[model samples]
Target chain A: MVVNMINRVREQRPLIHHITNAVVMNFTANGLLAFGGSPIMANAKQEVADVTRLSQGLLLNIGTLHEDQVEAMILAGKAANEIGIPLVLDPVGAPATRYRSDACQRILQEVKPTVIKGNAGELAHLVNQDVETKGVDSTGEADHEAIVRLVAEKYQTGVVCTGEKDVGCMEDEVFVNETGHPYLAQITGSGCLLGSLLTASLTVEGNPEDHLMATLSHYGRAAEEAAAHPDVEGPGTFIPRFIDALAMEVET
Target chain B: MVVNMINRVREQRPLIHHITNAVVMNFTANGLLAFGGSPIMANAKQEVADVTRLSQGLLLNIGTLHEDQVEAMILAGKAANEIGIPLVLDPVGAPATRYRSDACQRILQEVKPTVIKGNAGELAHLVNQDVETKGVDSTGEADHEAIVRLVAEKYQTGVVCTGEKDVGCMEDEVFVNETGHPYLAQITGSGCLLGSLLTASLTVEGNPEDHLMATLSHYGRAAEEAAAHPDVEGPGTFIPRFIDALAMEVET
Candidate 1:
């Protein structure tokens, strides 16, 4: 399954537009590149629509929410939607502030993304539920199936709750993907890269549910492979090996 | 060496203050987390100085330069310099515009950086040379030897030029650390991670030259290891494994 999508990406080399925060901008770009996808990191409102329209998929992450970036996400997301491109929304730190919650809600209402990727805690807050979130990081494990279900139903979109065990839920069906390592949580943009991976997978599968499943499985399997190597001791070394594994795994 | 740094970070988790661009901010933070360093992504002018004082290392990235962020970088970089904390600069998109080059020069003048990280093109521009930089990304190889001595001599700061081959250079000494797959270039924040790695390494090493050599060598070697793995296929898979490799390479 991973090989199939990897073949598609290598053959098609889709362009992904990201209107994300400044924090993970470089990592997100590199993640897409490792996945055999072209990345365009554009945030200015003037260029968002143009860049999004030209790309194959759109990823909107509100990690560092600001008035200008929020507007750009909306404009670019709308353009991507109208052009039949896949849209992935990463509502980062949504529950931390009213401003964030409102901005995320507005984007949800306006963009109507095909997939919404967030930590279980972030998902709970996005749907107006209570959650114990520390700063922007999730406090619970990735195996919380109930929270994933609630978020999927509330948003009417695919919900991916990533942690110790990642779950991808769409309405009634849920896929429990247990592929990643514990080291993933130690890093910041692990979730953001998952978003980029989902976008890359969607470029091939074109099904939000299947795309999410394949990505989580692919990421987890790669993490498992890395963990098997005693030399892969921590996150620093794990990062480069993870990319190397990605390049090979995609090709089957 | 990479494993030692990873163990050190885990043993003594340091808070890294970053006044970076909105882009790549999430990836930087995540890279820090993967390495066991806490990242604080704040760029507000009012609080930047206060925030820098508490950080073990300060990262200044001008990927998406703005007037307000420029001011904050100066304020934070100066404070970091005065407090004897290690300061690293990622001159993102320098020479793209007059505003960027001017701002970079200003920051360099106001605060003496412990180390500077960027591509060959960016480093060339930072030192006021004509390198034909394609936007923020480098078109040349990481070890373009042409400008290494020039950059080191002009800046009076250690420089890590990353690409297919990573080069760490100081005023009199230069080290060519080659490790990393070609696929790394496809990803965006791979360079940003090196910047964060430099910060994490500085928190422990204290010497700018040592930090640059350790970071470039460890990152380079890990990339080599990551590329040797069979299951690692693309960027998606490469990420986790790469982090694992860095964790193992940086010892406590």
Candidate 2:
């Protein structure tokens, strides 16, 4: 099947609602826009549910977790579940703090997320595998496959573990795409941007696994192209070209 | 007098404490790093004052204003003032919401900021000028110089109004730099990044007027160079190159 997944996203224009952290909001929104998806960020406890109701997908990223934001996310997550729209959870730095851990647990318990996208360390934490993370950056090693599979079965949701290799698991079926650049991790919010891209892709009518792998392949291809650009000197120079590459047609 | 201001920033490496908005945190941090200045963002009310004490300057951005964030900003602003460190305020989207208007008022009333940075419309609101703003983008026109002057005099602080022409006012003295590209406004947080740049620049010894003008000129030069790059296609393509140009030593 010719699955032009991202192009379909451009045509369908799925609006993805994000209740993410402070650091990556602009990058995440811009990346989604570059990849042909609409992004909306609302963070008030009073109107989060209303915002989630209008969006095609909801992304709850617990990076800069605040008490007020957690409350808002719970409301939005519940609304997304009630509306029958797909929800994606990025439990960023869940192991770093008690509040983050509790917030993630509350989300996993109270919300029925369609997909969970995170780093190996974050997913490993979700599946009870020990992996050390400092702040939001994952620094420890883990069996990504085991973590994704275990978390996939436990949460009954698609799981994605992103690193040098990107792995996605949906129940018994697992997929891996190893086409990314090292530079993706060098800059902030690449993983969060991927969560947004995956959420936007999942909103399209297709197999979640297919969409996951496609999004990974597409993002990796874009990163590879951006890193290879002559004008890109370092991480700072690579970001804009990466966004441009996302907007361009690359072989996925 | 020969003034290599940015190189001085690299040599000094001021640790700038930011209690700014959510959307532009990553970009602002990365932009500062690329420009060879250190940026630290702390949000919790408990640690903001402590964090501000360690830094050379504090930035209070009311873009993604929250009640919790306002409290943190107030505490940090007060600490910076007491420590005799400079504070830069970006009253982002002040006219859009009543909460934001009130928040800006509270900061202005309670905090003794050294410099205030914003666009014509955003600055106009502070001096009680009726200029309409949509979200954060300035839609209406005003006397940029007049706005800067009024705000600077009223607050007894240096003021910068950024647009096609960046106007800086310190009491009776005024400086204007006409070197920035239009693409600077196309991306999110360019103004906020400018606020960070101005804050970093102000920390360097010499005239705040000279530093403000030099920083605007440098940023504008970077934007012009980035926009003129062969690889740039649009705003997405413009951002990375702009950052790279910030890293590159362009003549101010």
Candidate 3:
């Protein structure tokens, strides 16, 4: 299933329009390109509507929220909705500042996204739920799962909370994939890159949950492989190999 | 001299304030961190003046220029000028767009930068020079040298033109360092990252010419080493190793 999905992504080369923050643009662009998807980062309100109309999927990330950027994201998100292309929202750094929190809530309220992804901290802002116990997991992990479940239910969209264990929740179906590296946290924008990968995967043929699981497992496995490489001395050395692994997976 | 400059930078950990483009922000930050300099990217016009006042140097790159960011650059540049913190201007992609060209010109007129850096194509816009031959070098190479020299003379600031060979000119001094690989061109923001390295180097106790040449040499050498690694399959793998090389050079 993963190989078929990879082949479809490479064959289709779907365009993923990004209205994201400053910090992760290049990494996200390169990662998408390496993974057999095209990325267009047009955030100007004047052009985003037209640009988003031409894309297959749209990704909105508020990693570095600004009033001007939020305005552009609204324009782009509306265009995506009108055109029926899938829209993915990653509310990065949400609720850290009043501006960030307001921007995320406004975006969620205004735009109808197909999938929502972020870390537990960022999604906690979206879920706003007090958690009870879930199985044998610790409170921390259980809290994350509950948050993901609530956000998925509330938004009527797939929710993914990424950490040591990547948890995906959609329509009473919960999936956990534990195949990542500690080095991921050391680097900036790893979550933002996941948003890119997820948005790209969404454009391919299949159910949203299937694409989401494939992206989650593939990204995790790549990080694991990259971390095991002999020359990956630290985060500095791991990023390139991780990128290479993302590409290598598609081919092999 | 290179070792001493690197040592000074590590000891000082000079804060470099960037009012640059969005795409390269993460890479520039990581590269500077790897090179042992602190980076602060704050492009809010409301806050740039205060931010620049606290920084040891300022780097302005027009890779992704917007009217709002241009305003912040002017504010930050003025603040850097006031505090006597060195400011380095990289006219990235000038003349490619009307907005970028205008932004570069406006910044040059408003800010007295300590050094001006770009490639031959970009410096051509700044110099506005008609070239003649120098020695037996190709007209292409000679044209580049003429552009670098004229810009240095016109700005009365150190100038660097980067390409296959990196050329630096200040007053009557012209230095060339030829130790880069094809892989450097394959990656995004390598030039913007150069602006970061040059800005960090400028804050140390050294002549502008000396620091410029050292940054050119060290950056090129790092690229060469990263490209030569057996694990580096392509540009995807080249970036992480290149970053590791930047950090490794400072330590070992």
Candidate 4:
């Protein structure tokens, strides 16, 4: 099933529209391309609606929040909704500052994302639970299943709470994926890139639940493979290898 | 001299305040860290001045310019000027949009950057010279030395116009560095990363001319080394190796 979903992405060549943060634009774009999806990053409010309308999926990441980009995300998200294409939200750094938190809340209330993905802290904060977040990384542990259920029910969307083990929940069903590596935490944008992969995965025709699980598993396994490279001494070397691994045709 | 300058960056551990676009923030930050400089990326207008005041150097990149970030860059640039720390301006995509051109002009006029870095197209646009630019890349080649001299003299700032050969000029003298690889162009943020390296290099005590040359040389040599790695099949694999090479303590 995972292999079919992965092959679907490579066959369809879906164009994913991303209104993501500046910190991970290049990385996310490269990752999307490596995973066999086309990426178009357009964030100006003047053009986001048009851009989102042309894409198969929309990804809204608030990693580096700015007032204008927040507005642009809303515009693009609504456009994607109107077109009935999948939209993914990555509430990056939601617990780091009020500005980010408020922006994520606003986007959530307005667009109603198809899938909402983040680390434990961001997902917990979205559901009004207390969790410690440093910058964009979650520093506190939460009951991933409970938090995912709360968010999935509240937002009426699929929820992916990622950490050492990734949990994907939709309605009452939960899927746990334990395929990634700790080295992913040391690199910036690992979480952000996962959001991009989720956006691409949703464009494929399949069970939304299975699609989300496949994305999490595929991405995590890729990181594990990259980390096992003999030359990957640290996070710096692991990054490119991860990209190459993402591009590989994995036999599931 | 290059080795001494590089050692200075490792010793001083300058905290570089970056008000750069979002497209390359992670790569730029990682590159700064790899080159032995501390990086702080803050662009919110509310706190840019305070952040700039606390740093050893400033980098203003207009790669992903938005209205609010342009204001924040001006704020941070002025604050850096007040403290008399070295400031580097990367006029990314200056020739691509009028808004970017105006923003670059405003920052150049007000901040008086210690070092101005851009490709031939950007420098030509800054000087009102006709040069073809495809996005951020210079599509046409002109007399790079003359353009660098014109920009350096007009702005009363050192200028580095990068291309196949990087030309650095301070008033009447021009230095050319032919040290980079063409593979560098295939990757995103390579030019933006160079601006980060230049900012870190400028914080070290040295002749401004030699500092610019040393930065270009160090970065180019790193790219060359990364490209030569047996595992580096293309730009995808080259990225991580490049980061690792940058982290290596080269004896210059």
Candidate 5:
């Protein structure tokens, strides 16, 4: 099933619209291309609606949130909803500041996100649960299963809480994926790039839960392969190898 | 001189405040770290003045310019000037959009940029010289020498016009650096990353012309080394290797 889903993504080559943060734009764009998804990064208010309307999927991340981009995210999210395409939300840095927390909540209340993905801290903060978050990194531990289920049920959307062990919950059903490496934490935008992969995978017509699981597994496996490369001495060398591994089609 | 300049950067560990676009923030930050400089990316207008005041240098890039960020750029640029630190301006995509062009001009008029960097087309647009630029990429040829000299003399700032051959002009003297690879253009934010490196290098107490030349040379040399790696098949794999190469402190 995962193999078929992966193949479908490459076959369809869906265009994914992104209103993400500046920090991970290039990495996310390249990751989408590696995973066989076309990426259009248009965040300006004047054209986000048009761009989102033309895409097969939309991703909203609030890593570097500002007042104008928050408005653009709402505009793009509504447009994506109007077109009835899948939408993914990664509430990056939600626990760090009130502005970020408020913005994420606003986007959540306004747009019906098909999938909500973030670290334990971000997801926990979304539902009024406390978790230690420093800047954009999730520092404290939380019950991933409970948070995933709570967010999934509250928003009626698939929830992916990522860390050493990734838990994907859709409604009451939960899927656990243990396939990533610790080296991923050393690099910036590793979590943000996963949101991009999920956005692309959602373009495939399949079970939303399975799509999220497949993406998590694929990304984790790629990181493992990249970390194990002989030349990947540290995080710096692990990045490009990870990208190359993402481009490689692995069979289940 | 170049070796000392680079060593000074590592020894000083200058904190660079970046009001740059989202597309290359991760790469830019990672590249700055790799090159032995500290990077702080803060764009919120609420705290940009404080951030700029604390940093050794400032980088103002308009690749993903919006109304609020334009204000933050001006705010940060003015703060950098008040502190008497080196400030670099990269007019990314100036020729592509009216907003970008206007913002670049506004910043130039208000802040005395220490070094102004861009491609032939972007520099030409800043000086009212006609050159073809498609989006952010320079599509037509212009006299690099004339544009560099004109902009350098007009703004009384050092000018660096990057292309097949990079021309750095400071007043009557012009230095051409032919040290980059075609593969540098294959990756997004390569130019923006250069700006980050330049921002860090400018923090060194030296001739602005040598600092810009050293930055371009180091970046180009790293790209060449990254492209020559046997494991680098394409742009996907080139990124990590480039970061690793940048981390390798080679002799001048």
Candidate 6:
């Protein structure tokens, strides 16, 4: 199924709209391009709506939310929702600050995404529960079953909680996939790429669960391959090769 | 003088403050890193002054300009000038739009940069004349002696115009460098990197004319080397090799 989905994405290259933070924009663009998708980053409030109107999917990442950027995100999200394009929300650092948490909630309410993907603490914050979020990174594993159940029930949409293990849950069904390297945590924008991967997978698969599964398996397999190469040192070298692996996957 | 300036930049490794557009921000960062300088980019109106105060040199690029970005650029330029950081201006598309032309004039009038870099049309526009600008690219030769003299007299600052042949001029002096591949223009942020390189060079060479000559020579030499390699086919392969050459230049 994962291979089929990968092939599908390569065949049908979808344009994904991103209004993400500045820190990880380049990594996100390269990741999307490697996975057989195009990325269009538009931040101005005047043009984001127009850009989103023409894109296949919209990914809203609130990693570095400011007054102007937040306003632009809301405008883009509402536009995406109106146009029936799939919206994926990455509520980065939600529990760490009141401004961030409030902004995340506002985007969630306004966008009404088909899928909400975040770390354990971010997901916990969304459900109105207290969780420790260390900056933008997740420190601990989530109570996968309990949190997923609560989130899926409340939002009536697919909820994805990512860590060492990844859990994707709908209202009644849940799927767990444990296949990623600890190296992912050492680098910035790994989760951002994961969000972009999910968007790319959804361009191929209609079912949200199928989309999540394909994305997880694709990322897991590539990480395993990239880790096997001893010369691939640290996060910097690991990144370019991972993209090469994704491209190789497309060919085979 | 240009060769000695290049050596100094590799030795000093200054921090460059870049108030640039979103599309070329990451490329500019990577280019500076490869050349042994640090790049700091922040566009918030409130924080631009503070960031500029800490930088060794400042680069202003208007590749993807808007109202807010133009405001931030003006603020940052003024701050850089006040702090005595060498400022290099790349008037990306001043001849393409009224807003851009007016903003460029406003920035020059207020900030009073040490160096002004642009193509023929942009230089003409700065001197209160109408000239054809082919999109973001230049329509005339960058090494034209007449244009260089005209720009230097009008702006009362050092001027560098880049194309197949790059020209550096200040008042009565002019230097022409004819090297670099056409492939350099195929990439998205090549000119932005040029702005960054000029900033780094000026940190080592106090003279804007010498700084411009040094940067253009190094860039042309590196691109020539990259093009000589058998595997260097397109912009993708050229970028990594360009970085490798810059790094090697530092080490050698």
Residue-level lDDT of model 5, residues A9-81, one tens digit each, is 9989999999988778888999889988999999789999999988999999887777889899999999999
Candidate 6 lDDT tens digits, B1-252: 756676777678788889887767877898888877889998889998888888899999876566778788889888887888889999886765565677788788888777788777777777766555445556653436677788788778888877777777865789898878875764556777888988888787466666677678878878888767765544445567777776655333
Best by DockQ: 1
- In CAPRI terms, where does candidate 6 land? incorrect
Model 6: residues with Cα > 4 Å off, grouped in runs: A1-13, A129-146, A169-174, A204-208, A233-240, B1-16, B21-30, B33-58, B62-69, B76-191, B198-242, B250-252
Highest-scoring model, TM-score: 6
* lDDT of each residue in A188-248, candidate 4, tens digit only: 6788899988889999987988988888888988999999989896567988889999998
Query: Which pairs clash inside model 3?
Result: none
Task: Provide the RMSD of all predictions against the true structure, rounded to 1 decimal.
Answer: 8.3, 6.5, 7.6, 6.3, 6.5, 6.6
* TM-score, model 6, chain B versus true chain B: 0.92
Clashing pairs in 4: A22-B22
Q: How would you encode candidate 6's per-residue C-alpha lDDT over A63-131 as one tens digit per residue?
A: 888988888888988988898877888988888889998888777676688788888888888898766
Give the lDDT of residue B88 in candidate 6. 90
Candidate 6 C-alpha error for residue B38, in Å? 6.6
lDDT (C-alpha) at residue A70 in model 1 = 79
Tell me the spans in candidate 1 whose CA falls farther than 4 Å from its real position.
A1-6, A97-99, A141-143, A205-207, A227-234, A249-252, B1-17, B21-31, B42-65, B70-252
Q: Say which prediction, candidate 3 or candidate 5, comes out ahead on TM-score.
A: 5
Worst 10 residues of 6 chain A by lDDT: A243-252
Per-residue lDDT value at B243 in model 3 = 94
Candidate 1: tens digits of C-alpha lDDT, residues B14-60:
77888776656666676667556777676556556766776789998
> Each model's DockQ?
0.25, 0.18, 0.16, 0.19, 0.19, 0.09
Q: What lDDT tens digits, residue by residue, belong to model 3 across residues A1-252?
A: 788887788888787888887777898877877777877666556556766876889999887777888998998899899998889999876746677778888887889898898777777767664333222112344467888887888888989888789899866788888988888878888888889889888888777788888898889888898899897889988887888788764644
Of the native A-B interface contacts, what share survives in model 4?
0.25
In TM-score terms, candidate 6 sits at: 0.68
Positional deviation of residue B171's Cα in model 2 after best superposition, in angstroms = 2.7
